[model samples]
Target: MTTLDGQTALVTGAGRGLGRGIALALAAAGARVVLVSRTGAEIESAAQEIRSHGGEAVAVPCDVLDLARFEAVLDGVGPVDVLVNNAGTNAPMPFVAVSPDTFDTIFDLNVRSTYFLTQAVVARMIAAGTGGSVITVSSQMGQVGAADRSVYCAAKHAVEGMTKALAVELGPHGIRVNTIAPGYVETPLTAPYFADQEFRADTLRRIPLGRLGLVAEVAAAAVFLADPAAAFVTGSSLVIDGGYTAQ
Candidate 1:
């Protein structure tokens, strides 16, 4: 019964999939959630679902890549106790085939957005003098390279790097920064690839657990890291990859 009672959390990319799961889990744990995503309708629907479950949530349409708009979105929501940097993009292409544009797109969404959003939110947390948690949703690719995932791996590795740096800088301010690395979660974003039976089987084989992860499982990890239960945790990556990286 980990509770975030009286805490306010903002979850980026909450329109669907892992983001949605994290948002709902936080709300269920008694945190007032702010759901942000480019899709206003989807976020609104997610907020409504939270309300249906007797949880509190608000919807905000935001494109995390827009640094200018990032502050505005936070301002609209007011003070936050937790910031989940879950917005990211993946351009799966062989290293040789990856173009500059693809690299830029992946870095912009996955790395840049996480960096600046944490900056903005930390400013607010420091001002309020309230200890806060920053959770970045990274991938197992950050720890191990996968074929045709060069750009994504780069971005996630950058995420891990920043997480460690920020933990050092912000720990003095009572702000904890950490990352959660998920491996082969079954989500809409990965649905098409999983539909390929051979690809899905191979993925499962790599995960020593013998199955793909669930959105709820990842959500639970996010909630744990964000909760005061992990107050002493920082600069650490809690890998929820079902032993995918153990080998």
Candidate 2:
């Protein structure tokens, strides 16, 4: 039997990229997945792909930044056994040139959404009297500072803090909260940056693995943390940066 058999998982921003990869991985482990995203078409397409692979999945279109709509989306999905707060946005601008609006946009989606959504999901998990996992997709930026990523780093740092606090508060209720910090995964969001030969070379030089990470690699980490194998683990951040942080 699969590790996640008989569980229900919700992966936000699951239309594509890292979120989609995590959703598919969870489904492969025998969980019925709920794909949440702002774009209905993308989520639907992803759900269909999961179905084609004999995995059970459904698409739910909702913006994470909108609490009301997010609550509605939660209601539509009913009780969720796992909630992957993977929806996030980043505007890479120098600290001196960053605007309030830019900061708010990133925090609203990355921090606010994660905060409230976890509250909602943990409430349900408490009521059901069963343990559940809440995994947030953080970044290496959260751990270390980087140029042109001040706001992004702040948001992810907040996410890491929240993860710890939530884990402490929810431990009594059998709910696990953790953050996955990826170094530099190859995704649609980072594709442009990776396309630049100079940038790519610089990034590769930092990673001891000498290559960029795959979405599937990050997804596998999610699966490990979400499954019973990690039952004793909580209030932690898993760094999947291929030795970038090691240096």
TM-score of each: 0.98, 0.98
- The 10-residue segment of model 2 with minimum total lDDT is 65-74
List, in order, the clash count of every candidate structure.
0, 0
Q: On residues 1-247, what C-alpha lDDT tens digit does candidate 1 reach at each position?
A: 5389889999999999999999999999999999999999999999999999888999989888887887998888889999999998897888999999989989999998899888899999999999899999999999998889988988899999999999999999999999999998989999999999999988888889999999999999999999888999999999999999999
Question: In model 1, what lDDT does residue 22 have?
Answer: 97
Which residue runs does candidate 2 get wrong by more than 4 Å?
A: none
RMSD of 2: 0.9
Candidate 2 clashing pairs, residues 3+ apart or interchain: none
Best-matching candidate per lDDT: 1
- For residue 7, what is the lDDT in candidate 2? 94
Which tens-of-lDDT digit does each residue in 110-218 have in candidate 2? 9998899888888889999998999999999889888999999999999999999989989998999999999899999999999999999999999999999999999
Where does candidate 1 have its weakest 10-residue lDDT segment? 65-74
